[model samples]
Target: MAGRLRVVGVRVERVSGRVAVVVSLGYDGAVVTGRADRATGETQTIQVAAEAVLEAIRQVAPGQTRWGLEQVAIQPMLGGPAVVAHILLEAEGTSEHLIGSALGRSGPLEEAAAEAVLDAVERRLGWFTKN
Candidate 1:
């Protein structure tokens, strides 16, 4: 185990005439992925990435811990631009907001978006590992 879930792969494909982004996250033994389709005229680039990562997280999360991707965007900042992800965590009648970011130039934007999502949930999901 690498002590946390890592982005195993991120890629885009065309499915049924729609563009889809697939994000895969995994530990050592098992891998899970989620996919989101982009509709025509969609403007937000990272929305599909966020949604795909959220779906992937849900597949491995414990019961009753709901994760929501409120917003995701790429913004310019000091030391180069970055992709930011806003996450909402709801569990046990409590809710917490978390934010994570990754440098946009470090990798492909779709891949960076997935990594940012993992950053947002890393602490919460770190304790759970593959058996």
Candidate 2:
């Protein structure tokens, strides 16, 4: 929140054996991947640094109050650098029901996931650019 509000598209993908939420951060708007679990029509997203995505988790799973960051990476994007924060969940039975409601339904999971993450960031840091 110290800097200007950065907007980058987000993409979420469930690959071979990992669930990743890619985002474009301050660095280069890189892909910030995180592990996810989908079951019973519910999705639970876990990431390192509970504070980073605490808002999203809580929003989806009100009971979720803890998390940790698995990996943090920064990659290059088209115009600017991308920042990717790979997070790890603490529990195994995490839910995925909060996907649509919490994360926006405009794009992929990564984008929605990014919205969730940013939602927390804005709450903690305050709106980057207020109208």
Candidate 3:
């Protein structure tokens, strides 16, 4: 097994109802980012986005991990409604980065983003397990 993965930072941004999330890991300088569109325009978009991001992190690096969320940013975007997410991850002990993205509504967007991020990380680290 490799060394444990740690989350060093997190950022959540919201514009008008769309959300963008970034998760940074300490090992190998990995960073994962995602976005979502809220159909209900709920006020808890940040929390939701954070959950999605964390879930993504959990999927990629599953055992004996540390979470060090550092930052979160939220704002309004002046544009139409759209949902999209992207992630750039560098697994520990490796130099190459894994990138992924997803597009859809809020619920699907979250799942898609998480899947994309995890898929990239798993491809490199093979640390995740089904749950």
- Candidate 2 lowest-lDDT run of ten: 95-104
lDDT of 1 by residue, 1-131 (tens): 45468888988876565668888888767899898888645745577888899999888887678899899999887866788999999987999998998887856788878888888988876543322
TM-score of 1: 0.85
The TM-scores of all predictions, comma-separated, are 0.85, 0.33, 0.32
- Off by more than 4 A, model 1: 14-17, 127-131
- How many clashing residue pairs are found in candidate 1? 0
Rank list by TM-score: 1, 2, 3
Clashing residue pairs in candidate 3 (N, C-alpha, C atoms within 3 angstroms): 14-75, 15-76, 15-77
Predicted structure 2, TM vs. truth: 0.33
lDDT of each: 0.81, 0.37, 0.43
List residue ranges in candidate 3 displaced over 4 A: 34-40, 58-131
Q: Which of the two, 1 or 3, has more TM-score?
A: 1
Compare the candidates by lDDT and give the number of the best one: 1
